[model samples]
Target chain A: MQRKKSRYIVSYSILLILICVFVLLSICIGSVTISWKEILNCVWGIEKERTYADIIFQIRLPRAVAACLLGGALALAGYLLQTFFHNPIAGPFVLGISSGAKLLVALTMVAFLERGVKLGSIGLIVAAFIGSMLCMGFVLLLSKVVTGMSMLIVSGVMISYICSAVTEFVVTFADDSNIVNLHHWSQGSFSGTTWSNVVCIGVVVGITFFYVFTLAKPLGAFQMGEVYAKNAGVNIKRFRVLLVLLSSLLSACVTAFAGPISFVGIAVPHLIKQLFQTAKPIVMIPACFLGGGVFCLFCDLLARTLFAPTELSVSTITAVFGAPIVIIIMIQGRKK
Target chain B: MEKKEYYFHAKGLKVGYKKKPLIENIEIPLKKGEILTLLGPNGAGKTTIIKSIIQQLEPLGGVMYLDGEDMFAMNRKTLAKRMSAVLTNPIDTEFMTVEDVVGTGRYPYTGKFGILEKEDKRVLKESMELVHIVDIAQKQFSEISDGQRQRVLLARALCQEPDLLILDEPTSYLDIRYKMEFLSVLQELSRQKQVTVILSLHELELAARVSDHIICVNQEGVKGFGTPEEIFSEGFISTLYGIKVGNYDEKSGDLELEAKKGKPEIFILAGNGTGSALFRKMQRKRIPFAVGVLWENDLDYPVAKALASEIITVPAFCRISEKKIEQAKQCMKRCGRVVTTLDLSILQDYGSTLRELYDFALQNQLVEEK
Candidate 1:
């Protein structure tokens, strides 16, 4: 117990340190590089170069914070989906929940932009929530019919393809004026987030994350499987519904802000679980959130800097690292 | 209201899936500290009945009273505090230790955060100790051996500190040693803590040993419900399972497959407790055999009856009469071989009739003296 407690502490500390490093690196290294000294000066209001403060505060800060928050939301959503389905591979992206959100948010964006009505972060999130719920409902129905883990994943992949196809179709038909903005947001990036988007993501993700944290106990019970969870006094029906709602809501918030970032949802929670060497939800939930933040912040930093002036989508970099981890998880699952 | 006669009582219960009754009018009345076991063949609705009681499947029709409170009326959390189950449902958990699994049994008692208080910790420790799994409390639940996992689950159930415990085939996959260990823990808990236990078991012998009351179930419904002594009456188990080829020895709880059918090829002069092992060996070899001049009350009677093609015997505790002696001599003369289970010195106490018969076999070169 003592060793496990220390391991959890060390793991969380490592994730926190990584998050801080990535956040700082994200702020420092950009198209116009800012050194640590300059960043410190800017923060202290010295502003040796005014552009440094402008880039740090106006551009990098909000985008980096958006990456961290939305990344945590994705991973938390994955954790909840995994718990809900008792399938480790179940996640927002793979299950096409994010694509479903993407499809609906795209339609909403085009429809509202056409009418000269701006879609706020809240509007997009609500639209994404409805979209993810519809996808979740379809997956739930498929889960009953398919039953096999691989088959469920196959069905989810199929759903992903269909939703992405419909989303692309909607984007192609949208008015020319909104196409550029819609196209960038649809590619799954943290590049264009504003402070208002950051604030909205924070409030929604914060409240939902706290709600999921409060469910850590029942979630722990649920890890034992449905029968045992029910035996342990959880109302399995209600708990299951809450898991679906919260998981979809988190993924919806992510899709609304950053489009559907790939693999982080399925990969980060698994990595955290391995690091902690236990799945006690109390620890896993918070560790997953922090680990997710670190993962996204790092991936977002790489996406922006790896090609520099030609910034890659966050999903592109996340998929490069996160996909292999998911493959490893699948191979390990098969070995078991 | 009628006075409560049983700590856990269910009357006229019906259980099935989708409100279609598979077994109805089931009655389970158990006292505190008593164990009632459900026994039946596979797919015989034992799990359905147990599931109904656990509220996993809503009882098709019934009223269950636990400590005189209507069980179905109670919420899951309220009932969970008083009743807990160890189900056959496979647990698919990852990275969870045995301690973590067992600690979940404190779900009803824990606070909002589910942190274990001192009392909860004490119960967890005591429960693990009860099942003798304190040593493996840190082991991964998934990586443990099946026996250890069963014990761990039992420990988890015990951690509920429940007044009434329900288990569905809790000993199904466990080996004999673990089965004995698991059931003995349950017995000790029932005896010492006065927890009423209800479970289903496929092992009739284990069920007979552990259950204070046994309910016999078949596809039709509850066939018999009584104490193990009553439920285990002569040939009842065979009839219940529709066994035609084998015999279930109610007296000794021994089960034997269909006996070899043929004329006797070997005859044995056997008595007391000596002949059973040899009898079983011959049965396994599918060889026909006979035994003679043994008192009916010999310790080997059950096995001999289960395996032997023919037996020439005197009444229990009676001397070997001349008529029986002649019959045994004639029986040995017809067989190709004779084997004496008793030593020559020990044979003297079995009576002179058996000595004369052995001498007759010796004269005829039929007895294989060893």
Candidate 2:
């Protein structure tokens, strides 16, 4: 057992190495493949005023960082929801929380565009947060009424559909010239990321991540479910509220920045657990952050490069990989 | 020796779901190093009272004191340090080994990060060993069988090093051997560690053997609470569970469903204790039987008293009375068949008056059930 657990050290190190390689790969290999020498020069401020420097600093760097942060946030959000619901496949997307945020963010965008007002990064995240919470509240209420895990997941799928339909309705009839932009954002790409947006995502998701880390102990207790968690001294009501808010904040951040990116939230944490061979939150929380970052960075690269000038949606790339894992998980769960 | 002071006490407790009380005016008390068993049928508010006392369900009205402190006034961590419970909640410890599962019992004592110290590890190891699950400690919880899983959970609760342990239907998934082993381990904990164990058990025989106190709960309330001796009197268990079809023999802790409620079809010459199983077999065969002349102190009395359609009796010391013999012969004539394990020749050689009754059965086509 000790020998097996030592593998966790190896897994963590491997995940860290993967994160580094993927971050660099995302930053260095964009449409115009800037040479390493030019990339080094731009980062080191040797050619600060050059176009190479502008592309590296203003565009790829912030976008890559946002993908890393928001992706980690999404996976951690999934982990929290999985723990909270005691369901392995429960995720922000699966529970329709991200779609909820998408619906509200789209509403906010349309409402602002009608008055010729632009929503800021903070404004978008706040709008998405409210939407995620609203959807989360509805799912929780459904959970109270439903007895089975399948029923809960089905209700969540229905919620995702309802939110997606409303977002489509808002997008189609909007008279703004930026309706094209609304359509693109709804497809969930990591493009249009700014340094300011990166900062907001960093502060919010970063703080929420740390808060989640603090909850690792109770979260571990929670794996045994509510009865044992209470016996283990967890203040369940307060802990439950914190769980909902933290998970909402994370998926809300992802939806605000990149639209409702799919599969990374549910799949990444599961992949990490398999890699580590243990679900101890002390290890899984950080592992999910790093794993989610690498996963999204890889998917985002595939999204941008696969169709070249006609970039595919990031979620389309993630769904291609993530949806299969979800299917496998369901099959395995049924077998169990 | 520990004095018999109450270690836990609950008074006037009202418990239910959604504040709609299912049971009311409950009171129970326990002493250190004693085992208490709760007995009730399904959905009799047994679990409700357990959950309520553990603070999982809010009591509509009550005050509970643990170790002389007002329980509701205590802090969660403090209460946790003193008490632990093994409930029926399903565990989803993904990839968690039994050791890792048991290590969770250290949560209340560990730092905010839930890192186990040497002491916590010591407690965890001792708990695993106590439950005889040390060999399986390295195995994943999901990989173990249901019985093993239950043992792991008990080990987890024991790892808390609590003064009081609560369990609900703890032995439900266990096989008979594991059931006895689990109860003995709890008994050892109670004796050696002075731990108080309060649990619900479905087996009345087992409950009678182990409990220092027994509580019977129903939808109405706590129907009865006392020593096992007090609780086992007369139709207490039957009335408490509202059993209509069966009879629960308090003395022997045997339950017998209403015997074929008609005239006797078979005459059973039950002697000594040889006919208890045959009595049950007759009952199962729907053959109402009249058993002859079993003394009150006889081993077969309890069972025969439960299932026999008619019993011919006489004072045990005196030889079977002529009047009782006549009565037995009359009842035997009514039976479609008379079966006896007794040999007429043996009874004649022993000069027992039962020979007369046996000879009377012989005239009526007596057949011995092997």
Candidate 3:
């Protein structure tokens, strides 16, 4: 028991160190490098305007915080999906939630470009939210009709395909400028994150995180099997629906603000599982948050630094890292 | 007969999938301090009935009462307090210890958080002791043997201190010894604690021997529900399985087989509690069988008595006597075929009765020695 507690403490400390590093990296390594002292002074309102410190404080600080929050939210969403479906491969992307947001963004851009209306980031975020909500609503409804996890996954995949087709159709008819916007949105990036968007994502994720924490025992019961969970006094139907809603809301918020950043959602939870050797949500939730923030911050760093001045899409960096981890897990799981 | 005060009462209960009823309009009463075994063929809705009673599946029609209170009116927590269940599916938890798994039985009383008090731990320890799994208390649940796992699951249910404990085919995956041991444990638990047990069992003999009440379910729908003797005598077993039970063997206390023509001479070499099954099958086929040099206190002795077969026995020890040898020779003289079981004692004495039987078969050409 002492050994187990020490191991838990070690893991928690490592996550804490990673979180600290990511926060420092987020604040310190932007376009115009500001000294740590200047950044601190600017944050504390001791620095004047019209300086690099002001840009660092006003723009990059909120953007970095948004990255951390969105990363945590997406990772938590993925953790819930993986447990709820009892499928290791399940994620926000697999469930068509990301595709739903992408489809909505494409539609909004196409319609606005046709009417000579220049759509803002807020307009796109709203459209993404509506799209994600619609997809979540459809999946929730299908979950009622389907009892098996595999069947629900198949239904989600089919929905994703349909959404992708619609997005493709919009892309084909959209003007050049609108097509560029849609392309950038589909390949998720954190370039447009602001203070308002960060606060919105933070609030939504905070509420859902608290709700999921309360549901930790039920989720642990689920690992035993659904029948056992029911026997243990869990109202399976009600708890499952609530879980899905919270997960979908978390996924929708992140996708809305960050344009559906990948890998962090799909890979962080799984990495946490390997490190912790458990599927309990109580452990997985905090692990997912820290792991996601670190992963996303690292990927963001790579996306910014790999091409120097030219920015690469965060999705590309995440895909390169996440796909291999997922493959390795699948292969190892199959061998077992 | 006086009606027993039942702890769990199912009244005209109709359970099924979708809209169609699987086991329809069946009324059964499970009294406290009773072991009720549900015997049925596949797709007979025995599991369906158990699931419904446990509220895992909702009954399509009719109501169930638990201790005179409406079953549906009780919340899951209250219902859990009244009843606990052991399912056939293996629990896939990796992190929980045997103690942790069994302690979850206090979930209903502990509320959703599963906080354990001194009384709860005492109950958990006692339940573990009852199942004889206290030695492996700190072991991970996944690392236990199958028999040990089954017992641990029982321990979990027992920790609930529930009035009714439902089990679905608890002995389906167990070996013969574990099967008997598990049933005996259930029987003892019910007798000592006044806990009502309702388990579906496929082992006919074990179920018949241990259960106080038997409910035979089939396509005919709740074919019979009464005392074991009452249900067995009603021909419910034959109807439920669509197989004939010719006669009851008073000695072995098992159903005997009717005689058939063209019987073979079978010399069973089983002893030291073995060959009961071979004896039963040989009786079923009406093959004339004899035992050689069986000890006085062996499982086959009772079987031989039940079948009314000729037997040779030594009072004690491994030494074969002249009188027993003569009895065996006399039986061999009248028999057409000679069969020997692969028993350890018979194998040890390769040059004795086995070789003697081989030589007799060779000379008489009655059968080729196997």
Q: What is the TM-score of chain B alone in each candidate?
A: 0.97, 0.93, 0.70
iRMS, candidate 2, in Å: value is 0.8
Candidate 2 segments whose C-alpha is farther than 4 A from its true place: A41-49, A110-117, A172-176, B1-5, B261-265, B329-338, B342-351, B355-369
Evaluated with lDDT, which candidate comes out highest? 1
For residues A1-336, could you state the per-residue lDDT of candidate 1 as single tens digits?
A: 789789977888899999899999999998898889899999999887777888999999999999999999999999999988888888999999999999999999999988999998889999999999999999999999887788999999999999999989999999998898889889899987889889999999999999999999999999888888888799888888999999999999999999999999889999988899888889989889998899999988888889979889989999999889988988998998
TM-score of each: 0.97, 0.93, 0.82
How close to the true structure is residue A29 of candidate 1, measured as C-alpha lDDT?
A: 95
User: lDDT by residue for model 3 over B192-224, one digit each (tens)?
Assistant: 888889899887888779999888899878888
Worst 10 residues of 1 chain B by lDDT: B342-351
lDDT of 2 by residue, B7-86 (tens): 98887888889969898888888888899999998999878888987899989997888888888889999998999998
Q: Per-residue error at B55 for model 3, in Å? A: 2.0
DockQ for each candidate? 0.80, 0.80, 0.35
Q: Give a tens-digit lDDT track for model 1, residues B1-370.
A: 3258889999899899996899989998888899999999899999998988988888888788998889877888888888999887888778888998899999999998899999999999999998889999988888998878888888898888899999999898898888888898889889988999999998999999999999999987889999999999999999888889978998799888788857888998887788888988888999999988678788778778888898887787677888888888888888869998866565654476778888899999997853
Off by over 4 Å in 3: A41-49, A108-130, A137-155, A175-179, B1-4, B111-123, B135-138, B234-236, B244-260, B263-370
**Per-candidate local distance difference test:** 0.89, 0.88, 0.76
| Cα lDDT tens digits for candidate 3, A1-336 | 577668767887898898778777767776667678877787787877567665675676776787777788888888888777776767887788888988887787788889999776567657776887798888878888997656777888899899989888889787876777667766788776667777777777788888888887778767767887677677788988887778777777777666767656778988887677655566777878878878887787778768867889888899999989878867865664
Distance from true position, residue A316, model 1, in Å? 0.6
lDDT score for residue B10 of model 1: 92
